[model samples]
Target: MEAHSVQVREACDRRAWVRDSDRSSCKECTKGFSLTRRRHHCRVCGDIVCHSCSATVYLRNTTSNVGRACQSCARPSPDQSTPPPAVYCVICLDPFAAQSDALVVTLPCQHAFHRHCADPWLATHDECPLCRHQLSQDRTAFLEFISF
Candidate 1:
């Protein structure tokens, strides 16, 4: 009985494999191509990145394959090189640098929020600035403790 089940599973798997192989295509242009001829598409934007064009990205302390971004459309301008610091306000997704007071505060959760942005933010939500981890709103309340 077990042998019969295993044989059936193998047949099913082989069919699926063939189906996938038939569907394989170029990552960028989406034209049908072979692995030897086609470059991997970038996971971010699904752009085709040939061998010379692919860029490797290291994420989550792990190395993963990523296609290189083309020069003109590639992200992170080398000439205008800005620090790769987090830009969005954790609380509002607003650009952090544009705040008038430069009063963006980093919550213990490693999330940054505008001092004013956080006060009202805290009233409705008591989480980390970025991931919204429930924070100590009443316990030894410090920082921009909102009165209202």
Candidate 2:
């Protein structure tokens, strides 16, 4: 008899896809959006897509995790291990140096910000206020890496 191994799904939170406001139409089809038709996000490219244009796939992680992926994400790509560059907060322009007690948060793009300042801004926009870099999916992991 041959032994079989069952792959377990890794615990994860969904990646924050790009905001719908960034695009007026589906990225894949380039079809214009309307009130009735809603916008969806591709977990891979973080682009706004339509229901017909998106498909769910298990992306590479510790174990394959299900996520809404675009056609591009479904394709394989070279693995990236190098960490992103570290960046200072653009909102305060001080890189959390203004206050010793300030809570700093680092986004996926490697930009850092005061948690208090970033909280309100993040509510309205997903990108960094200064560099306009998109937020990463593994926000918690990034936060853990930078927390001091």
Candidate 3:
């Protein structure tokens, strides 16, 4: 039989209609995919998301564009055991890369502090590293009391 004749016979048996313009037909159910009509594009793959299935994409290591991703791919997995980079001292503008020689003096507002400069500076004053909240005398007294 001719190729076209064979194809026509097959299509007739399946009773499937060809939709050239509409791409939202669900592959599983052969029905309209729901999410496509509401949003501009698929939230995940940037494809034309239909009503039935639009996925959100979430990545742990990298940031993603919002409002385009769908739910199936949302909620990125937990990150690896690698710790984030250390913070730098705001006052001295020094990067705190290691724990050694670094004094973790906590501020009154519960902010991280450096010991090298803050300890000596607090000798005569009691202010926060950034906000300068008067904690120098109080901190000194507390330290002196603790040492005893």
Point to the candidate with the largest lDDT. Answer: 2
Question: Given candidate 3, what's the lDDT at residue 79?
Answer: 53
Model 3 Cα shift for residue 11 (angstroms): 82
Assess candidate 2 and give its lDDT.
0.54
Error of 1 at 123 (Å): 2.8
| Tens digit of per-residue lDDT, candidate 2, span 39-123 | 8766566677887786554344522233555555544344634344334556766544544466666554445666777777766
Order by lDDT, highest first: 2, 1, 3
Q: Write the per-residue lDDT of candidate 1 for residues 20-108, one digit (tens) a residue.
A: 34435544445565657665444334444444444333111112211233222344334643434556666567776653555665543
Ranking 1 against 2 by lDDT, winner: 2
Q: Tell me how candidate 1 scores on lDDT.
A: 0.41
lDDT for each residue of candidate 3 in 3-54, tens digit (9 for 90 to 100): 0000000001112333434565543235565444442343333334344443
Q: Which regions in candidate 1 have their CA more than 4 angstroms from the true location?
A: 1-84, 98-100, 137-140, 143-148
Instruction: Note the Cα lDDT for every prediction shown.
Output: 0.41, 0.54, 0.39
